[model samples]
Target: MKTTVEQSLRAYLDDKTANGELGPGSRLPTERALVAQLDAPRSAVRRALDTLEGEGVVTRHVGRGTFLTESARAGAEAAPPDTSPVEIMQVRLVIEPPVAMLAARLATQADLDRIVECLQAGGASSTFEDFEAWDAKLHRAIAHAAHNGLLLSMFDVMNTARTLPVWGTLKRRTSTPERRGCYHQEHEAIVGALVDRDPEKAERTMRVHLEHVADNLLGRV
Candidate 1:
């Protein structure tokens, strides 16, 4: 029921009616004509018209086309939303590595304090969910040091799109001291690079760290 065709047609019709091009009791163009005008399918045009008629915004006769009812424009503006997840990751691929670099280049002793806390918490957390929460905090700490509001805003949105459901499986499969120790050691290396204020080294180290995760995700390792 939530067709792009319907949503676009609704907006087009609403705008025309608001500008007095379509008034109450006005018969819209024939369904076939509308399909051509909107570049939508015949089924889409019929569905939009059916919805309009059902809402009393338009009436249909056996031979005549749909007409605009008194309240035709009121409810047409409310349509369901369709958002894409890829749209979010595209932004992350632009922003996060640079944020890690910036945090190393610009972070003061005070700024490093917070990042150190988050890193420590992440390394120590026993539960996968708890570790993930602290890990997110560690990344957010780097974003906070970027000193650019737009980049930070973009980082927040990207963080919301990261959906890795395999962590629980890995947690159970690798439930041993050595596997957990490797994770902690890798994180410590990243934090150590950041603490040394070497942007290039930190960025490369973080990328290598994430590449390990990428390998696991793709089943390449």
Candidate 2:
């Protein structure tokens, strides 16, 4: 299991990479820099980097600084298979409740802050495109809060699948203002459970939210 500091560092890296701040073969900041920036212990920083290197996300050299692996960058941009909305929902139902449960158990103050930011931004969105973008951000924030590297990686892949044209077309066809309002409430419930650190409630709320989404997207539970 990762310590809180290690998890925080991983989430930081994930966010940086996603936003194109750190790209293929980009050198990571120095250990001293990371420690100061993350307010993390040097040892914890080293450990996090070690774990990431072991996972093939980075490379280290004796005199050179760490660099993101080319493969890691490629993997993030790779296209997923053409999966149906029902199939994606099935996978989400199986994976995300547990993810939310973990987030409730593990999310730190910073994680909670990011999740709430996404939630508020999504709720305030005026267009379906904006709302959908924030919706993806909110889910990604929750996944990061889970602080399980492998699970986060899997969620990233599943999220990529959602970018397919078919998924967007279906969502556009099915979207209604009422449904979006319902989704906002559901998001609030999920975040509330996380803030309360109620793992069981978090899991239940996440399952409920996904079931509603599946019903909207697939026209059946």
Q: Compared with the true structure, what per-residue lDDT tens digits does model 1 show for residues 14-57?
A: 78888988887788888778888899989877766643443334
**By TM-score, how accurate is candidate 2?**
0.68
Over 1-221, each residue of candidate 2 has an lDDT whose tens digit, in order, gives: 54477568757778999898998789999999999989988987886675455334566777999998655654445545667888778888888999999999999999999899889988998878667867877887798899888887777667656756698799999998889999999999999999999999999999999999988788664
- Measured against the true structure, the TM-scores of the candidates, in listed sequence, are 0.52, 0.68
Report the Cα lDDT for candidate 1. 0.63
Candidate 2 regions with alpha-carbon error over 4 angstroms: 1-79
Candidate 2 clashing pairs?
Answer: none
